[model samples]
Target: MTSTKIIHEKKNSDMKKLLGILLSISLLLAGCSISDKNKDLSQEHLVLSTIWFQKSPEAKALFYQAFNIAKERVVEFNKEEGEKPKAVVVDLDETMIDNSPFQGKMVEEGKPYNPEFWAEWTKLSQAKATPGAKDFTLFCDSIGVEVIYLSNRLTTELEWTMRNLDSLGFAFVTPNNFLLVDETSAKEPRREKVAEQYDIILLLGDNLNDFAEVFQHRGDDWGVSVVEKYKNEFGRRFIIFPNPMYGDWEKSIYNNERGLNENEKFKLRRKAVTAF
Candidate 1:
């Protein structure tokens, strides 16, 4: 073939190859868009969890049981480790107060969590105390043990959080006792700060990460595995409340992915469930 013709043919071939690659990429993106569109994104999955949290007698019983056990553990700690000043660390959201109303609103509207709505919810300062939480904290205060609320809520929400606690008649609702998220969501640093001043006799939270660093950044099975490893400390050193609505456990189900759309989250959640 003539050299000019050969060069022209090669240029045509390269152009065709580039076009094929572009077509493949376009098709792949189109397929992904359609798949996401078809997947369920409504907050329907939150219904049962919200219902159980807001309406179930069993849920209330569990909270009361956990705090009752916590009281006993506190007495034990004072008897055994009475030499040092002590404190009890607690997570505010599900540990000391109920936010199921927020969850229920989401379910009712068939929408996922909206930061704006959540901010408004916090501003309202309407969350009620979980069963037995007030009594337990007050009991600790009466006995001279410090009650520190270490929560992941942003520092900006501190005022409303305090108002909510105060409205619920919580004892020791002071700025020094309430530590909200500042630099990071991890509680270890904040817990360490409390440890420096007082021996933390007990830790109360719905999520395992509230107690230790071991529970953070693990696989789906890591939560269960770590819990098993510390099984003996459940009632004594850890008082876990029920929080079926949302937690790190759900994040693990999605492989700890951040900013996953509701559709992607629903798919992972369904895949994580066992079926016959």
Candidate 2:
């Protein structure tokens, strides 16, 4: 055969092989997809993202950096000095603790969140600390600053929540210091509880609510305005961790209404996205 004809045939063969490989991968992904009657496109994407986010070394490193920054600011705030005891409030899930397993099970088992499943998961008391959390909280303890946990986890879940925190060697994790969700999830009242006892120097969490009430049910305009207003406080007094799994940020789309089905929420989320 002529050299040009031979080269052309080889190129064609390579293209065919590549196409075959791509087709196989496409089919594999298709097989992974669920065909539930209540399909919402974001679930698989969120699950995969959560897995990657929780397992990645980058995530661990980011937590390390955030905690380190928190440490530095604590020192500065301490120097400023007041008789009020210094305290730092931290959120539990996705902040101090990793709850990716619960999220993973939801995707793996082809299930959506149910109170029963969530309660069971918390009761297991199996969550581990986010990287650097133990060290940071312990550092706070050594520095004479109280470490308080203010979480949206119901007050009823305290037993396992404390067990989980204790197992992870979290410092200053006591019944007196761990504030759970009460009459409201706004967390302000709980935050106020802590405020009365100590001068809250820092707040850390994955959700913005972990910081304050302004973030809860934050509509589009209000959310943007407040964030812009407190822009400087982000990494300073408000240290935030990444949470790809879930948060109030997700709830805002549906306006905190529990009545919306997955499909309806999905449609709203689609409309909510701003594309150029």
Winning candidate number (lDDT)? 1
Residue range 125-230, candidate 2, lDDT tens digits: 9988888999998899888889999888999999899888899888886799888887877789988988888999999989887898777757756377778888
lDDT, candidate 1, at 17: 100
The superposed Cα distance between candidate 1 and the true structure at residue 264, in angstroms, equals 2.2
- Which prediction has the highest TM-score against the true structure? 1
Tens-digit per-residue lDDT, 1-276, candidate 1? 999999999999999999999999999999988765543337878888889988999999999999999999888887665555999999999889998889878776666777788998899999999999999989998888889999999999999999999998999899999989999988999999998888899999999888899878666574788778889988879889998899888877878678898778878889898999
When summed lDDT is taken over every stretch of 10 residues in candidate 2, the lowest stretch is: 36-45
Off by over 4 Å in 2: 1-42
State how far residue 236 of model 2 sits from its true place (Å). Answer: 1.7
lDDT of 1 at 117: 83
